[model samples]
Target: MLYLSSFTFPNDDMEFDFFMKIKRTCYDSFYPFKVLSRHGFERIDFEPVTILYGGNGSGKSTALNVIAERTKINRDSIYNKSNFYSDYVDMCEMHLKVDIPENSRIITSDDVFDYMLNIRNLNEGIDQKREKLFEEYLDAKYSSFQMNSIADYELLKKVNATKSKTQSRFVRNQLMGNVREYSNGESAFRYFTENIGENGLYILDEPENSLSPMRQMELMKFIEDSARFFGCQFIISTHSPFLLAMRGAKLYDLDENPVEVKRWTELKNVRTYYEFFKRYEDEF
Candidate 1:
């Protein structure tokens, strides 16, 4: 789980050089020329697991997307570096030894929602097709029993009447079976657990999106187990202390000009959670 060396990107257009190493680490941003790095932070190398922490619009998601896109990791979102007033864009030359695992994949809330919607739509379409098939069978089989003038119509009705209600029932059951039963957060965590596998690099963007604190902790444990027992490597962007505090997780504060790593307890988001939890400690 350790990367033996480091690399530098000589030609990146973000007004700085990109310095990184491969050592079970994560870097928020390593634009080495910047003076005002977040929390006096600089590029960080991580342990097998890493977390990126920052506030809204602090570039946490942006950094995650960059890593995912740069590493050719499967992602739910497109990465872009648009310049003002033109279709031309800036691209980064990334350096690292990380290779994406065949079994590993990125999961986003957007991807999950779209997947569920597609399943729903597919089931609906199947229902429609089944109805049409039943009507057609009725028309073809019962045509001879009706009066000549309306024989075709009557036959279709008769055919439909003969169809086993069991067919419809089976189709309906299939449509409803195995459908997502959990809340969005629960579903997301479940999906994360299901998707991650051994010896793979997974880049997750804001995995905490739909998870409750308890679910987030569950996700944290899942990630820990995957990394420890399965040889899985993770690069995650999130503000969840539950995840950020994962044993030995490296953190990069993206709010700085140049991203850098600090202890989970030192992160602003973690501190906020700490203060809030402490305030309610007496009541509990």
Candidate 2:
């Protein structure tokens, strides 16, 4: 299930040395250069499931994007980067167990949002087309029949078909059905299930964005099974405890000064949630 065994990036000292040797304009800011270089983010040891956990500005997403870029994996949405983005990527390397599958890709919040939006937009268009189909059906069904020319053959066939079929059947025959309707959470979850495939490596950025707690738990299990049963490995950046608590996942606390690995229960984000729920335990 593990395609990538290790990932190495420039350490703090290396980044500092490179920066000192090179000259940059005062206006040019290398954002991740400072943030990711803080710890020994120089090397990351990956498992079937590797998690990057941290608060905002902690460089977790930066690390995932850097790895995705370096690996030239598939990605749904474009990740934003500073001017020094390539310079930062150049300083990173990976050791792979096997060639990364072509389906291997990175999924970000923007990708999921766009996917849901596209479904909604597609359904709207389909609705309009269906209305037009209704008008066409009525016109065809009630039209006076007079096939005098070859051009009228098409209308003659449609009239015969419409007369034989019911209005609902005629509309169904004329138009494509709308994409299956789903709520935001259902749509978001569908995105993952549809995009992720067997024997592929996936990078998920903040997958909990639109998912409710129940949906998050479902996604947690989906990811767990994907790694365990399917030949899929996942590198995820998330603040959700439901995802954080996936059994046997490697947890790197990016919030730590040195970015050390820790148990999920010991993580600051997880403890915050635990405390909140524990304080109101009796209410439940």
Candidate 3:
């Protein structure tokens, strides 16, 4: 299930040596170069389900994107890479247990948000079309003009059809149904289900953004099932305790200086949640 067994990033010394060779000061940053090396995150030994846990600006995302780039996985959203981005990726290495599936992809929050936005936009367009169809139905149903010749056959059919059907039914016949209306959370979850197929590697970046606690738990179960029952592998960056607690998931705490692997319950974020909920146990 582990397509990618391990990956190595350029260390501080490598970044320093690379930067020392660069004489140009026009670029403001060497981004991915210094990002992971800052926390001494030199490598990742992946599992069937591996999670990178960290707060904002903790380089978890950087690591995922780097692996995605190095492994040539599919990505929907365009990530901004600095001038040194290629050089940084070149310095990194990936050890694959097997050839990465062609369907393997990196799913970012932007990808999910964009998918939801597209659905909303499509529904808006369909709604506008439905309004126009309503006006057309009324016009055709009440039109007094007689059919002059064969040229008016299509119009005649429309008039007869509109008159025979109710407004809602006529509009339904004229236009496709609204993209099966779903809330933002539902849309985000759907995006995941639609993209993730069997026996492929999927890198998900902060998938809990639009999901409720209930939905996060649902996703946790879904991911667990995919990894266990299906021949799938996952590399996720997240802070959600629900996702972090997935069965057999190896968690690397990016918050740690040396980026140590630890149990999900031991993560600072999970501990904070536990303490907060424990304090309110009596109220529940």
Q: Give the worst 10-residue stretch by lDDT in candidate 2.
A: 23-32
Worst 10 residues of 3 by lDDT: 172-181
lDDT of 1 by residue, 191-268 (tens): 777777678877787888878999989989988888888887777888787898899787777765556568888888
lDDT (10s digit) by residue, model 3, range 1-284: 88999999999998889889988899878787778988899999999999999989999899999999999999999999999999999999999899999999999999998998888899999999998998999899998969999999999999999878999998887689888868899889989999999999999999999999999999999999999989899999999999999999999999999899999999999999999999999999
Off-target runs (Cα >4 Å) in candidate 2 are 20-27, 140-165
Alpha-carbon deviation at 235 in model 3, angstroms: 0.5
lDDT per residue as tens, model 2, 1-284: 98999998888777878888876677467866877767656678998999999999888888898899999998868767888888888878899999999999999999999999998899999999999888888899998989999999999999998899988998898788999979999999999999999999999999999999999999999999999999999999999999999998999998887889999999998899899999999999
Which residue pairs collide, candidate 2?
A: none
Give the higher-TM-score candidate: 1 or 3.
Answer: 3
Error of 1 at 88 (Å): 11
Per-prediction RMSD in angstroms? 7.9, 2.4, 1.9
Which candidate should be chosen as best, given lDDT against the real structure? Answer: 3
The number of the candidate with the highest TM-score is: 3
Model 2, residue 202: displacement in angstroms?
A: 1.5
